[model samples]
Target: MYALIVIISIIFFISCLLFLDYQLGKRNHIKNLRFLDFEPTTGDYNLYTNGDQLFTDLFDDLRHAKKQINVMFFIVKDDDISHELLELLKKKAQEGLRVRLMVDRIGSFRINKATVKQLEQAGIEFTFSSTPKFPFLYYRIQRRNHRKITIIDDEIGYVGGFNMGQEYLGRDAELGNWRDYHLRLIGDVVKDLQITFFDDWYLNTGESYDHIPEPTSEGSKEVEITSTDGGQLEDVFMTLIQQAQDEIFIGTPYFIPSERLMKALLSAMDRGVDVKVIVPMKADHLFVKEAGLPYLSRVRKAGGEVYFFDLGFYHAKVIIIDQELCDIGTANFDRRSLFLNKEVNTLIFNKRFVMDLRLAYLRDVQDSQPFDDHYTQLFNLGTKIRIGLAYLVRPLL
Candidate 1:
């Protein structure tokens, strides 16, 4: 009895310490939040669903870069394709062009010290973003820079879900036929992308560039770049949902939304909006799919459609509303994206672009299976327990 009492006391004391840490972390995060809302700019944009095509165009742009190249990604795996990209950047840097590469410290943990030395030797500037520090260690560890963007010569930009990996090129045996959405852009929006990249670079390196090129219209399509550092994302998503009058379509690898965002989605359905969501049938992370089960079930019950994409690992982060405006970028429709990560998304306000994206969404849906009652009924005792745990620690997911 004495030993048992001591163990209980220890557990209670550790739990209280953790609770205090969490509260302090929350306060610190709110105090340092940053959000940016760029004005709508005219730009020419091409959406790439094929990874091969995207990298081909991107590599070509890198090769043609005249003055500078800035690249950032959440993950840059130590794989064949990543090596190819690093080599290209090294060549560019050696040619006296400014080259900077930034990757998330945690997401790209596979990038070792030897690679950093190689990059530096080649005159390429490299740094890791969102490295965990003191103050709020636990909270800081959870906060990631989830934005994936590239700017070349302050004229061309690439943004979307594609990271530098062979898996992204549909070579992973476990996740076959990788499907995602990415954008290649030119014109005024490229300047916005550069500004976003500069902001992140400044945060990590304390280096700032003063020669941001002036905006020039390249196309008629209107676009707004929204960057968030664990702030204002929920409100942005809520406003997008609340303004929908005809339909809503979302595609994400994770679906664990905040309570308010979920409620707004359901309310959109209640008001006659045709709401649809697509998620992966296979989970890449632990407890993520299970966490979304309850929310997906509720969406189905409320006449909103849910799809499980079985063709491949669906990693597209997109939302289309009323075939009028759409969001596409690194932000997932999950709590981590909506409340914790540093993310960037493009709000495109062109009907033609929206319809094109909507068509692609439907194509993906046709390749998916419905999230019906039978699907929910397939959960067993273990899965149900995981679902409960997922809810208990959802903010961290």
Candidate 2:
């Protein structure tokens, strides 16, 4: 019994030490790789607000795709956009386009394999990313390819928080007023997106970037691809959050920011910079909503203003600073988005995009509702206590 107890204690001590070492290594890695090399003096970039025109552009790129079409998404539901895009993809595949797609085994949960089998039968290659379809064992399979990305003909790329969903496009009656931003990328940066796509594709299909992403003289002069976070890579978005100066404005449907981000925001506020945040009045996730309230309350007390868009559930993720730096992609502020989910975000240091985003801020402000402490007044002590405790595990959200 004594020997067994000692062995157990030894194992526990080693585990704790390993975890601490991992955390320290992660911190150092983040410090080293988070800030991507963006030439502040390079490129004239444009930003897109609505999905209609962006979808048209995406379609145009697909129509032009001759050699390859690579796409990877967390979720591909049976929405109008998905169907239309799939039909277009099928047509291209029929026309001898080397079309390939990767869907998350975890996120493409509700979607049936039969839905995509037709494309496979039509010669379009398809694969699933880290799919776990078990019972209690499935819960442990938490890491996911949460990125929503599409690369057309290896030239044009798309990334943002807007998944191929009706709610994201704000067309469905159920989602009357969701707001999101996606970049229609056409540049060398598309290579980064393609690299990301290839990485996910190979994780499932064993195909390299050479097989999926063909080199071309054609690249987007406007922007380049920057990563948010990959499995063990530093979260570039978090680094960007820390780089805020003069002004900081964020619009994310899920607003559960990490403690590091929260501290940065509060510190920025403390510096007297005008900071404004917008989130959904009604998030699609219930536990997230409950968890987010306490943070908002804390933020409000810290001289920050929180606006909740009541028109509908807004799924947009944007962060603009000083009308100079802007990023629009499918990343949210929460831990699931930042650390666990396979998310992507681009950094655009273009004056034009930032200026236009300022305008978007105006439109979003017009449509959003303000959140006050009044909503929490009805909550009793027990509920408040639960919310406070829920935040302790925010790192795992």
Candidate 3:
């Protein structure tokens, strides 16, 4: 009995430690917040669509880099674009370009040892996130560096849902299609993204940068950085969504936003704001779809517009408020993105960018199927019950 009590006590102690650590860590993170300095800078910021177009723009910006090129991604596959990018990096490195690359271990499984060796041979610096034990610290690693950031000369930056792979370049013969949203910001926001990359690099390499550069765009950018854990801007995002006065428009592939976000949407509708949401007709993850449907009732009742895009897969995470503020990044509307996955998004407040992003959203709407009144009739009682159960676990998803 004493042995059992001791064992139970040990278990209880570990649980309490983890809980306290998690909470205390979050508070510490809040104190050292990143978004407190987000203000717009001067530059020609724009909203871009499609993987190929985004890559083209990124490569163009990279070519214009005078000092450094840093990239932190989750996947780096050996497809057509990946190979081409590697070749270009090699050429640029031969020209003495300071190039650094990092990929997540789980996200880049298809990238074998040979490709890594090639990058090394080309004098490119590389790092891997989440090493498993044995020689590595094995398993139990949950937090992923899911941030998508690319900084060139510490001047131009790119962030969004696009990951490294054949699909991003739209050259995936297996799937035959890849749809995503990546933004190009030419301002001080790039500096914040650069800092994010530096933090990840230091996490694995134990090295620090001498001087983190600032955004060089002409005007200012009112952007905020949010995370799933400590230094969380979940409340910040929630506040922004709830505060929408005229119209609230969002496009997300996965639509499992937290209850707070859902309530904000419903409240927006209640106040007679035109609330609009665009989600994939067929999501890459099915359970997320199951979890998202139940929220539609309140949304529809509040007179919101829900749209379902039908072409290929609509994998864009975007939020536009009153056609003034726009958000684009890897964070989906789901809890996984909010509290599980490492996501990065940028909020562009310029009216021109908003108009352009709204046009892009409307262009996507052309290929979309509107989620109208028929949805409530589309699913039966059994489905609703299961989805409700699925939603209960949203925070941990």
Candidate 4:
């Protein structure tokens, strides 16, 4: 009985320390928080749904870039495709073109120290964004730089879901074909992307870059670049859902939304707005799919349609409202993305582009199966237990 008392006392002491740490972290985060917003800028964009074609065009642009290249991604796996990209960047650096590369410390943990040394030796500026530090260690560690952006010569840019990994190229046996949406853009919007990149670079390293040219319209498409560090995405999503009139189409890998966003979605359905959300049937991480079950069920009960993409992984983060406004970027619909991560998305207000994206969304829907009561009944006892556990700890998911 005396030994048992000692063990219980130790456990209680550790729990108290952890609780204090969490409270401190939360307080520090709120103190330094600032939200971001940008007006719509004109640009020319081409949406790439296939990985092979995207890399092809992206590589060609990188090779032809004359002045500078800025690249950042959440994940850069230590694999063949990543090696290829690194080699290309090194080659470009050798050619006297400025090259800077940044990746999240957590998301690209697979990249070793030797690779970074080689990049530095090749005259490429490299740094890891959002590295965990003291004071608010837990909260800072959880916040990731999830933006995937590339700017070449201050004239061309690429943004969206594709990351530097063989899995993204559909080589993983478990995930057969990778389906995603990315944009290749040219015009004034590239300047906005460059400014965002510069700000991130300065945060990582205390270096600021300037000489950004003035914005000039290159096409007829109007695009707004919306970026969020944290605590702002829920409001953005809610505003979009509230303003949606004719229809709302959402495609994402994870469907775990906050209470307010879920209610907004349900309210939109009540207002006669057609709401359809498509998520992957296969899960990439633990507890993610299960966590979304309750929210998806609520949506279905409110006359909203839910789809399970059966072809492969559906990793696209896109939302189309009335086929007039489209959002495509690195932000997912889950709580972690909506409230924790640093993300960037483009809001495009162009009928032609929205119509094209709508067609692609419909094609993906055709490849999906509906989520109904029959599907819910297929979960086993173990899955049901996991679903309950996931829902309980959803804020961290």
Top-lDDT structure, candidate number:
1
Model 2's lDDT to the true fold? 0.70
Q: Name the regions of candidate 2 deviating beyond 4 angstroms.
A: 1-46, 133-140, 211-224, 230-238, 373-389, 392-396
Model 1, span 113-231: residue lDDT tens:
99999999999999999998887777788899999999988888999999999989999999898889999998888988998899999999999878888755566789999998886
Q: Which stretches of candidate 1 lie over 4 Å from their true place?
A: 1-12, 215-217
TM-score for candidate 3, please give it: 0.82
TM-score, per-candidate, Cα-based: 0.97, 0.81, 0.82, 0.96
Choose 1 or 2, whichever is better by TM-score: 1
What's the residue-level lDDT of 202 in candidate 4? 91
In model 2, what lDDT does residue 28 have? 46
* Candidate 4 lDDT over residue span 252-307, tens digit each: 99999988999899889989999999999999999999999888999999998999
Q: What's the true lDDT of residue 121 in model 3?
A: 86
Quote the positional error of residue 292 for candidate 4 in Å: 0.2
lDDT-better candidate, 3 vs 4 = 4
